[model samples]
Target: MRILISLCLALGGLLSLPAFALSDSGQQALGQLQTRWAEIRYELPEKQREAAFAGLAKEADQALASEPKAAELLIWRGIILSTWAGAKGGLGALDLVKQARASLEQALAMDPKALDGSAYTSLGSLYYQVPGWPIGFGDDEKAEAMLKQALALNPKGIDPNYFYGDYLLRQKRYAEARAALETALQAPDRPGRELADKGRREEARALLAEVRKKLE
Candidate 1:
């Protein structure tokens, strides 16, 4: 009787568990997006990149549709749209950038700590990289604040450090930029992210060279 009672108690506990966390299918979708994004960002030729990003955007859209409030899905969608804008530059790209900004904003609202604070890093990059008044909503102060928040959340993360470094370089804070870039270069590799790690490290090295020139 005691054994049977314990079994029922365990079953009751299992049944009471919350379902707010990501489903297995949602996790799988996020992994697929990461893999495909890395391939598009690192392996695809420049002429083919925009088309690839369009496909990624579609995949992200589907993933979000399946799990509308999934913070990770929203973050990936934002990233896909942002990269698509960069690949499809011109007046047309402005709309894509706006959409990307909105997606990231929503993700931030949902879960600011999701994906190691990736939403903050990407949004910060957009703020500094885009145009200012009359064209876009770029603002150095906003960018600085977002990037600093991202760094605070993920002090040792590669993307946050690299982006912060790039922003510093653009602001002509060469010394600080170089320091951040160096830290990015030393970041640990993530599983299933070999291509991304290689590409980002190369970018950091290239930018570090430019920073060195400015210092000299």
Candidate 2:
């Protein structure tokens, strides 16, 4: 959990705008995953998150098995796995992150712009959050590049901006972080995602408060 403070604190929502290519079955499966994921992520107790996310990750895996070609499902799977790893924590979490990275990369290869470039958002978060060198493939440069690409694709997206701002805050670029986070706060509400939007705004506000303190 501590390993992903930057991301968890910054995560708006991994479930992105609909992908037109998704089959009816895949869309249904993704909807179920989306609703459950949000509930577990925002409403579940901290102690229960590891189990909840772990179970959901497996469900995501199952969903992908039925629609191996759906980039949206794969992206969500990556997000679920990444958050699962965060909730699990410790040496055991390494394998989950690796799997998450693989899923995101596959989604990017399948469709770089799928889900409003959500694969980029998840991948960027993982790159910076995971360890580097012998431990994992975490790279600051790669993270920044991927994040910037996400921003280019969806400048008004809450997740990309929040994650980028979080990354900037981590890099000690407080002023830029504040600007990015403020942009996140200004993102328009996403219809049918009021809960997620509320949660994301709360996160952005919390992080913005931190950024403001740094500015002072």
Candidate 3:
């Protein structure tokens, strides 16, 4: 009887092992997909951005359905939707924005600290971009709060820093914007490295030049 019980326990463990391995594999694949998505977004031509993001959004949707509670998948979905909305333009974009916000909110509710507050960063940027009317959607105060929460979670994250810096620059808070942009520029992550080194380099340099002009 003792030997039989031991064998049963061992068999149970073996049965469960595959599930654990599969979950780990799924998580790793999601991470790789995210990295690739970010890299391609920066490298791809402007005209191609929409189609690329749509493809990613479809993948993310399938992944989310497969792992309903996966915070990472939800975050990726939100990112893709937000990008899609941005690419398409006009009020038609609001539907995608709302979808992105819902997904991010679900992600945050599932795990507030997931992905180093990535959900918060995405939500913050979304709010910052929306207009502040009854239907428009922008809220500067909420954007600032969310961005600050993200920074608290991961001070080195590039998205929060870059978006917040852009907000400050728009507000003509040059000093603060410069500090935030510089921090974003110095981030060690893939998104930061790609943005600062590629698409945004010229823009950032021009902004810095403008700052110097204002100072002089």
Question: Which predicted model would earn the best TM-score?
Answer: 2
Q: Per-candidate TM vs. native?
A: 0.90, 0.91, 0.79
The alpha-carbon deviation from the true structure for residue 160 of candidate 3, after best TM-score superposition, in angstroms, is 1.9
Over 1-216, each residue of candidate 1 has an lDDT whose tens digit, in order, gives 111000000000011112235688987888888888878887888799889989989999998898998877887887888888888877677787789889989988987878777788888888888777787788999999998988887887788889889999989999999999999998877777777788888888999999999999
Clash pairs detected, candidate 2: none
Candidate 3, which segments miss by more than 4 Å at Cα? Answer: 1-22, 190-210
Tens digit of lDDT per residue, candidate 3, span 52-83? 77787888887777788777677778877887
Task: Report the number of backbone clashes for model 2.
Answer: 0
Top model by lDDT, which number?
A: 2
lDDT of each: 0.78, 0.82, 0.66
**lDDT comparing candidate 3 with the true structure:** 0.66
> What shift in Å separates residue 148 of candidate 1 from its native position after superposition?
0.4
Cα error, residue 120 of model 3, in Å, equals 1.1
Tens digits of per-residue lDDT for model 2, 55-157: 9888998988888889888888888888888888877888889998899999998888887788888999988899887777899999999999999988988
* Model 2, residue 132: C-alpha shift (Å): 1.3
